[model samples]
Target: MSGMINLIKMELFRLVKSKGTYLTILFVVIFSFLLFMMSSSFGEQSKANMLEEDNALYAEITEEEEHIKSGGIGFVGVDFTRDTDIKFETIVHSFLSSGVFLIFCGIFAANTVCNKYKCGFQKNLSTYSNKKWQLTASENIAVLAFTVTEILLIVFILLIISVFYFENFRLGSAANIIKYMGMQAVLYYAFATLIMFIVEVVHSKVAGITVTCLLSMGFGSFFFNKLDEILKLNNFLVTQHTIVYNAKMLPIAFDGELWGTAATVAICSIILYNIFSAFFVSSRDMA
Candidate 1:
């Protein structure tokens, strides 16, 4: 335990002092904010369009709502509001907030692991009286810390927009949001470690990062109306968390809780990532 602590502590010091971790977090925050701000004008136009679509959707539902009420499926006097349609704006808000979790974090964390080789730390670690698991734990801790830092910076940028740009931004029942973010932190470490391990094998940061980005982009666009189909197929893509904007309305969905899906995905991905990482790290000579 003491050795693990020392190992993790050393790893944290090394990562933090290097400034790459901090720069990654800062870049995610600032870049996400700027990206959103630049596109917000178009978003305003889109919002108007979405509101019109929402009105049309609700209008289409009014007759069904009244028919259902008359038939005893609902109370007779409950007049449905035309404004109760799906707010695509909320989803847009979420997307603008989460940023490129897959692409950005995947690149950075993978680099952190690969940087070990570049900086000669992997060679130096051979001289330390440390177990492989302890060292893995250290890297894991370092990656996890930066992951959370990156996510919190994201949340901060969201709050900035919510307070300044929008009105009536009542963030109700945001427990889901927090749960989703916590899940992302876990998932990021798992996927990042996996990429890191692969990077070490490939021994090329550019190639490793390029492949990660390609994979993330490919899987990010797989969402559909059939939730089961979407989630089932999405499970294979560990970085699917990058594109998920919001948890579906709960109490009515299976595999819709970002937390649940994220937990399962993270667990499976982490297991696979760690398994290969273990085999490789233990067997490979330092570069």
Candidate 2:
């Protein structure tokens, strides 16, 4: 336990000192904020355009009414008003809707193990007191990294909410949002660790990252959705569960079955990936 704690501490220090991690975090933050700002600006512009059209129509109607009153025989015009239909719900969840958050985080996950290799940290770990301890320490550190990443995400979300919304911005329930974020953190960490395990097994950073991207942002979700649709296997598909579980985080009635499937798949992935990573890490020659 003490060794694991020490490893966690060391890993946190290493991550904090790593420029790549900081750069990735900075990129995600900037991209996410840009997305939010652009969407808000577009929404406001749309509303303004609608109002302008309404005003123009009203002017035309009044002109026609004056002409008719003067017996100038102008055509009749109808009154019209543009109602603001901007859905706060859409704005509040724009981060998820934009797909930027997920993509950036998924890419970060793909690079986790590769970054370690590039820094020669993995090689140093091979010289640890015990080979098993090396893998164990790495696994714990991966968890710590995931935790940090998730916390950063929560912070980003809060910052966005504060900036984009000031009044009437409280999501359905504050408690629910916090709980939902906690659930998302667990899911994201499991997914990231799965990528980490893949990187360890392949021993090729490029290959590992490519596979992670495919699984997280590419054909993996597409094919999984197709399979679920054709085979009625939604409960067992990880990608499907990921989508379904994220939906449950919204301010609406939750689906128990989807939540259950998501929980089951997340737990299974966490267990299976870690076991496989440990086994491969133990057997592989570091020399």
Q: Model 1: per-residue lDDT, tens digit, 38-106? A: 446444554566577977755645565434322212111112122323222333334422324556667
Which residue ranges in model 1 land beyond 4 Å of their true spot?
Answer: 47-93, 96-99, 128-130, 219-259
Candidate 2 local lDDT, 1-287, one digit each (tens): 66566667777776677676777777766765555555556546645665778777556646754433222221111221123233333333333322234444455655666666566666665545364545544545655465557445645664565545644443344444455455555566666666667777776767665664454333454566677677876345444455323422332224476456656666777777778877777776654
Per-candidate alpha-carbon RMSD to the true structure = 9.7, 12.4
Cα displacement (Å) at residue 110, model 2: 3.4
**Against the hidden true structure, what lDDT does model 1 obtain?**
0.57
As a TM-score, model 2 comes out at 0.70
lDDT of 1 at 29: 77
